[model samples]
Target: MVHDILITKENPFENDVLNFRDHIHQFCSQFIFRKIPLSAVVGITGEWGTGKSTYLKMLQMHAEGKNKDVIYFNAWKYEFYEDPLIAIYFEMESKFKEVLTLKKYKKVLNDFKLYGTQFIKSVLINSISYVSEGIINLQDTKDNVKKIKEKQATLLEKRIEDLKGAKELVDRFSDSIATLAKIINENTDSPLIIIIDELDRCLPPHALKLLERIKHILSVPGVVFIIAYDKNQLSHSLKTLYGNDFNIEGYLIRIIDHEVAIPSLFSAEYFNKCADKVVLSNNIYIDKFDESYKGLNPFAVTNILMKLSLRDQQYIMHNIYSLNNKNKNITKISYLLVYFYFLGGLKLKNPSVFKLFESGTITKAEFYRKVLPALNPLERDEVIIGGAEILMAIVLTIISLIEGEQNPNNLTSLNLNGVNLEFNVHLVADVKTRMTTQRITNLKNIPKLYSEYPTFSLD
Candidate 1:
């Protein structure tokens, strides 16, 4: 019973997993449909795989259920276009055709295409001018190129005219959208909710261009935008376009009327539920492993999973299944599970450190410095300071076993050449209680055990 590593984009509201349905409903009914201003841009900010896409889907579902017109635009999907406006225009055109008759939709959108073409042409002509400026200057005195400059001079005059008409083009485009929105509003009795999703996944240039177009052209009455993104990642994209010193918050404030942070989905109960979903088989070893670790603090596992993004959590869970399957013969199933879980987390969070640790080149001090800091504050506190006795026991037992120690039941400390790493007395006791003497003796090849699990790339 192998589970797929990726979670399907099924409507979580139907099942109400993670209890997000109430939050989604409240946000849609209270804020989005009722209180939010028409033509407002609402930003839904969260890290990647923190369920931004899922939340947006739920919002769209809820909004449509309430008879609101919703258009979901995935910007990253159509980012290959030279201009974001072109992609946006086509999406609106497609959606508008659904509500209005084909003739009426064509009539309303005719002016939009006319002005949109002019606007796009103006941008292209300007780019050509900028790129060919140097060559034009260098070839100015050549008799062969003099006519080219004269033609370009005439075209520059026309470009000046096009520049003057730029404002008109923008206004017509806006008017077309407003008219469509009004028709939709008249039919649905609600403003059109345009959800722009995956903006953070776009290339930096495309992302910034999309933001600018949204702010300038798409800001109109009778239309509201809900943009989902990872704020930090979008900030990085902005910094890549602008300098690192650019004020991202200031720029976003001008575009977004409201900012909504997706709530954290971390909890012990939720973690256990997700774990159960991945570890579906009722193998005797798995049952024994669960029973043995039932006394272990839930945070011990939760801390590791919570450190990963939601997507990475799924991957590690899948990895856990693989690890458990490969090491089913091992008697210390609980210890192996915890060890592999921590390793999978380390692999995802810091591949470089994981590589070093995997190569057996990382010392204990290096692990303390690199791996400990790689963990989040809660993970560090739990896995190092509080409720870390089991983890520490696993680490010490593995180290002692690898160093040719037959039974580490009484092993309290290790001398790593000059460095002394002490183990907690309780950790040794816990290890002894969980693992038999024979189990420790048999689990000599820690690296070999790790080798049984497949290697994977984060990318």
Candidate 2:
């Protein structure tokens, strides 16, 4: 009855699983497609794997459906290119070619291509020269001094000329974009909308260069930019460029006219659906631990899942699925499902503490202290009221089961805050026997045991 955990790749507009249609409609109608006097850069910011890419896709489809010209550019896909401007220019050129013939817009495109290349090259050469001047030895001599002075004078003159040319080229480039935007707006009655996605995934220099290009050259009338990125990750990239002490918020404010946060996908209903697809689909018994132990609180579990990114949520679920699949008999003991869920949360929320606990380097009491503060008030209350003790008892019971005991005599009499919680020793034993066969002797081996499952990194 187990089902594989497949990452959903269907179009968000088609499926609308995350219920983003309303948000997409509102943003497009209210801000994006609405007529404004000046061009604007709007940022759609969210944490990594919070569905920024999918959201952008939805926005693009909506814009296109409204008869607005939309350009979807993924910066990371072109990170290998030295200059992001080149990639952006090509993307614009390609998209525009569909509406206007290449010959008609060829001159503007060529001018942009030629000047942008020259400007970038000039900057690189000047930077190299400036650096070289600092390291080069310049010894004074009657003949060499005159020569050096002459060379400096010539270089300074050329540098001024280059600067002027670069300025002229930049101005021309801006004018070309303005003209193009005007033409497109006149033809379609809507400003050209460009959706720049995955900018946070690019190298620091590439990402910063693209941002600079947008601010200085591409921010023209009749054009609007919707940039999707992880704000924190992009901030880190900015810090990598400007220094750790740089005012990231101040700088971003100057670049982005407005920012919209992606709506969170966490809710009790969402978690229940994920659970159905991941855990319950396997026919696992998750209703009650025993006559004394009730099922996991849906709200409490939602709170924990909310603490993790979408990628982490899937990761935890998939690992749990792998564990249950490997030891099918463990599914019969409904209470163990609670422990598994807790373990997954522990591993994700505080990996350092989880590692210590897994290696047996920390006791149950120590683990409890470290993880308690991370939980919400409700979860904290649950932990204090028999949750912690019951978890420890279950671990001991599982260990005893692994040791081939008919009954864990020590755990049989275990009491949790004056309440006795019974254990299904046979089911617990089955889990251990499978683990033993897999060479997993202790908690530390669990990660290795489930290492075959895919893992994702937060941006």
Candidate 3:
């Protein structure tokens, strides 16, 4: 079950979807072995759910095998903290001791450990933030005014003291990073590579602050930071912090030396890997699928799958398996219908339309209107109209029986636009819809839903 589990220990599927792994590995290897000035931040950016974390895990494995110091830090895990910078330092301190020899780097380890507790306290309790700069006017009694003025005077004095100590705190933090980098350079033969993941999942403030802190304080020459995130998302987050006019690319250029977008997973080989798993697991045959129908054609379907994330592809495969297991006779056609539902951006978005089809309330016109635009961009001559008509009618009959229509038993054939065909709708069992599709269109593009999501159907 590749659902919700992180691909940590195992390497990626190199002979399959992970063909991109070799290229990414070669890039990281070049950066490490070439010894072209370490301690720069490299970004592993991609859209959400595009196997960024999985790629990092593979990269971590590659680096570890080369004896490079590797730390896999998850930024989202510590987003609860007020200052993620403290959490960042703590994660590094915790991992360094585990990987490095204690006696060999005892003094440096101790220095790194010393700042963790004090920094936590300073961020949690003694931190001062800008409240307001405008003058205040109040209507109050003289005694109240006097007491407020005295309190302000005391607070102002304490703030001045805090401001005086702020420089010392920053110096201590910088010294620790520099000291750790130097000691690691001395003790270890390989560069220290820290892979920070899920930076995009952090809160807007935490994400921005973490990058700023890394740029200003923790930047050391021998330490290489590989951060995995969606750069577009991070840029949006930066805008949330510094207004719409924020120079996000400029800010990122200062922090990150190399920005690499995770390559797109768009290959027919990968699609076949997923499709083969789904079809064969249920003992279904590929030839039964209408190869002449462009949408169900394996190569044509691969084009649509290419646009989806790996997780989404899994979700679709799982759904197909679920649907296949419940029906026996028309297994091949059902696969096309399920895939088409997903390809056309149904199943998850527009439940009203989905429920119409599911509940057998979808009229012929409604089904045709909803499904036509989702078909492959081919002229009528390119598609086998006979296969398409028969397939659509078979799917409609299945929907009718699933919705528990009366006398739907012994349904052997279907008629579509005067084209008659044989089908086995009775083979479909009385199974209810199992999974609930959430409204995640805000987080993702729901296939063709945006431009093609429909309105109330008269039929």
Which residue window of length 10 is worst by lDDT in model 2? 1-10
lDDT of 1 by residue, 207-257 (tens): 988988998899887788889999889999999879999899999999898
Cα shift from native, residue 323, model 3 (Å): 3.2
- In candidate 3, what are the lDDT values of residues 223-255, reduced to their tens digit? 778899897888888899889999888888888
TM-score of each: 0.77, 0.74, 0.69
Better of 1 and 3 by TM-score: 1
**Positional deviation of 12 in candidate 1, in angstroms?**
4.6
Candidate 3 local lDDT, residue 169: 74
**Overall local distance difference test of candidate 3:** 0.59
Q: After superposition, how far is residue 321 of candidate 1 from its true place, in Å?
A: 4.2
